[model samples]
Target chain A: MDFEDFYATSKDACLRAVMATVGSRQLAEETVAEAFARAWASWPKLSAHPAPRAWIVRTALNVHVSWWRRWRREVPAVEWTDPIQPPPDDDLPDPRLMAALRTLPPRQRQVIALRIFLDLDTETTARTLGIAPGTVTAHLARATAALRACLAPTTGQE
Target chain B: MTQDLHALVREEFQRVRLTDTLDDVTARGLRVRRRRRSGSVLSAVFALALASGVALSLPPGRAEPDSVRLAAWSVRTEPDGTLQIVIRDLADPDGLTAELKRAGVPALIEFKEVEAVTEPGRLAPHCADDGEVRSPLLLSVMVRPTGTDKRAWAIRPDAMPPGTSMHFVIFSVRDAAGKSYESVHMSLVDGDPVPCRSVS
Candidate 1:
């Protein structure tokens, strides 16, 4: 696909997953924005991959962990300074669910992001994470339980 | 439910900012635009070349040239048993030789520009006398010089008996600008040079 088509289809969807994993909108936007720059520079290679969305998400996730970005390389990116607040709307997710998700470890958050937001199955999630299937299931189970409990107590209030 | 989690995540993500994503995509799309343009141009050029090559290799107008060549070879045996070959316009002497050879007549052919007729009373041998000029196929003949190329030539068949061959053709072209009237004369008697004779 051309760059426009790929970006239009993938940008919002990937942004959501990255946002869920990083637990901060600013960082997620910055990470995905930079990841997309890198993807465009080498789109011919990335577009051929079986899961380009997974690849972009993984690259964004890796930047969050890669010491090189923190210490060495100034990877191509723009500083994201857009307003982060969502307008008040009933369609917004229950605050309790978002709060419950924030409490989980980063690995479990990644599993939820890939599995729930991105809709990858177990094997693809594991591959995206560079982890085994059992580990993905374990993290997914724990994160689900935590969210269930957090939602169970809340009755239409954050 | 799995659907619930998906819905919740998608909904919350609606909050994040997205300002210059379109500009970024536009920049990326520009990078590949050259590749597409160049590929189309190359295909167009290749198609043009292929079409021109096919058009160039086909034959030119055949009927006109063939008819003119046939008229150049119009001939009849004189009452004295000599052959009278009328060459009116420009004709390939080599082609005329082929026609004569096919008619069981062994002969030699030669072509010389009019400038070659310098010796007094010995001009380049062509049909100038009225009796020898039955069909003036051309009104004028002009042989223009391109470089230092020679205009005089001679063709003597190896098989013709130089002394006994009674039938031979000495067709000569003139030195005028347009519509050249050339002639070919053949003798019935043994002679080294077939003298240009009266056609009547």
Candidate 2:
């Protein structure tokens, strides 16, 4: 697909997927924008990937991890808090679910984001994340169970 | 239960929109492409020079002063009045900035520590721009890699617009594995200088 078309169709989904993983809309938007710019630079190579959307999401997550590390070092530990805020718009995700997702380890959140939001299959997700398929499955299982546990009260399940 | 959980999580994000226009994104992408192309050209030239053992020769009867050679960097005025700067390390940014000014190029230099994964060739986040157009400033400077931890820059002071200065932000990137390297971004600013915010 032409870059314009790919960007037009995938931009929102990519933003939503990255926002789901990072739990910060502003950061997600910035990260996804950068990732898409990078994809544009390497369009020929990226266009051939099994899952270009997954590539965009993975790149965004990587950017977030880098930012988080720098922020962690510069800021005091006591000042660190979950950055998850209630969606400012009605169409955005629930703040409670975002908070729960943020509680997962970074890898688990990434696995769930790729699997559910980007809709990458196990092998494709593993390739994009540089993890083995078995590991991806393990992370997905653990993350799903934890999210379910956290949301059980809202779901009316004991 | 797993399917239900996945559905719930997916539903939450289904309606979120990026709001940024494609034109904006593509404009940023074009900048990225230009930056990458410049880097690639420099790398290709450096490789060819190394393979051919090419060296720069000074012009005979040149009145230029002897080049200032230091452990961290070297600066020399080319015969055509351009400044050739080779940076081996990021030490003594203030001294280097002073030397560049003395050599007749208006310049400011800063070194910052950032995440190793930070993308190269992008302007440092701390530096602010004056929002003025600077096509002339872009044409006045050229940078190429000289070695593993070194870079060579050629700046034409005459080509720079009056009241404009070259601001160089050299990032010191250290990965989790303790390996580190330096990358630089040079920008042209018009009018009064904008000081970079403290990263601390």
Candidate 3:
């Protein structure tokens, strides 16, 4: 298929993949753009691969992870500097839960997003994160535990 | 409590879609498509100019004036009739020839003088020199076709600032039999060293 078709079919999946890894919608958009640029240059080869969507997702995640290396920081602490849409107020019922999410370690956050939000199976999420399925399980367990503690009601607040 | 927490986390992410529909994604892809095509065009023009200079310096009949310029070090023919070009730039012609032999291509390495192409000097936002950088220690090795004029050459970017690299350009020119000849070019420079690796 042509490039337009490829992007149309794969962009959201790519974005979800990046958001899952980076835990930020803005970062996900940036990573997706860079990955699509790479795919454009190597479309002939990438398009012919068995799993092109997976390839784009992997590349986007790698780009996100590599940005941290280039900055000499293990985590992407670079704050969003431009105008951002305010957090949607529709379905989300708790502000404290969102705050608690930002406190989790980046990898744990990724595991929770992929497993719980995007609903990827262990193996696919593992492949996306370039980790083993067992590692994904470990991260998920830790993330769930952390969230349970962080989001629990305090004696006075509830 | 565990299930409740999971539910909350899911609720948070699901609420955060970026309003990015397929149309938005397609527009982004089209932008990339334009950038890539333009990049290929620029590289093609640069390769043609470099190849033309190489053709002028060739001994009377050895060079194909109409051939494409490539930056490859060696070329090989596949069993299925596809051509594979290995790119490199070093003083050792014999090593390149050996690589071609291993790949089963009828190989010929000719040493010739050609002007090096120079970069335009604008730094990319990421600090990558816009890839317009050129140095003269460059060389080209054309792969002779056993029965056809079409061949692939490998390119090696040698000789630039420390950690600097360049890409060779390939041109598709048709020979007398309406067949295509693919030529590759590479740059080799002093002091600035090339990684002992291949750029595909």
Candidate 4:
């Protein structure tokens, strides 16, 4: 697909996927927008990829990581315990789930993002994250178990 | 239960939408492309200058007319022997250091990729803060911003104490809007000082 068509179709999904991972709608918007801009800059090569959406998500996450590293170095004393900001819209994901997701190690949150939001297979998630397939399974299992425990009372699941 | 969890995630995220338009993305993409192009061109120019050996043969005591101005940085020597250094970009720290040394100032220039720190502690990676080395005379060699994007330092070699050398650690950070800013920490080191470990 052309750049415009691809952006039109995938922008919302990409934004939601990034928001789920970052736990902040504003940061997710900026990160995903920047990633899409990068995708546009290299559309010729990126359009031919097997999973351009995955590439966008991965790029967004990488951008966030870079920014976070810089921020951490600049402000070493401040703790980044709270990443989840209140969503502007009430229809957004449950705050408890987001808090739980934010508490997971970055790798686990990334695995959940790829598997649940992007719906990528184990091998694809592994490739996107640069981790082993077995490691991907392990992270997804741990993340899911943690989220289930957090949501058990509301979901009525043991 | 797994399927249910996945469905819940998908359902909730479906409500989130991106408010930015395609035109916005395209505009930002053009900016990114332009920055990349300019960076590559600067690298090529630096490489050519280094390959020509012009950067090494800069004469002592006075800055050459051509060597006085560069796209990334400039170094000039005043009649009284004070060296003026204006940095526009942090691309070639080695060349800058060489130029400073040629101008008769014992100098170590390091362009490090570090963000500005609000808290007071270590300034750069692998470089320790030595409170003993700081002196009132070193204040004369500090770099200050002359413009919005340019920072200039004036160094009086005569005022520098014996057995002392100037060390400049430049830190660069890009804001969320993609504009780059630089901060410099100047110190007077005694004898030979160890190089700051590179973190870029």
For B39-138, candidate 3 gives per-residue lDDT tens digits of 5966777688798875322112112122222332434444554445533233344455455435443233333222222236521111123334444433
2 or 3: which has the higher TM-score? 2
Interface RMSD of 2: 11.3
Ranking by lDDT: 4, 2, 1, 3
Please give, for residues B9-65, the per-residue lDDT of candidate 4 as tens digits. 788677788988989999889867875786686688778898987673222322455
TM-score of 2: 0.58
Which residue pairs clash in candidate 1? B88-B137, B88-B138, B131-B198, B131-B199, B132-B199, B138-B180, B139-B179, B140-B179, B140-B180, B141-B176
Which residue ranges in model 3 land beyond 4 Å of their true spot? Answer: A1-23, A29-59, A62-93, A154-158, B1-4, B44-200
Model 4's DockQ score:
0.28
Question: Across the candidates, what are chain A's individual TM-scores?
Answer: 0.79, 0.84, 0.61, 0.86
Superposition error at B92 for model 2 (Å): 9.2
TM-score of each: 0.44, 0.58, 0.44, 0.61
Candidate number achieving the greatest DockQ relative to the actual structure? 2
lDDT of 2 by residue, B61-166 (tens): 1113323222466677777987877665567778888888888777778778866444555432333434533343353354322211225567778877878777
Tell me the lDDT of model 3 at B69.
29
lDDT winner, 2 or 3 = 2
Q: Please, what are the lDDT tens digits per residue for candidate 4 over residues A103-132?
A: 889889888888887778999999999999
| Predicted model 4 interface RMSD | 8.4
- Cα misplacement distance, residue A90 of candidate 3 (Å): 4.3
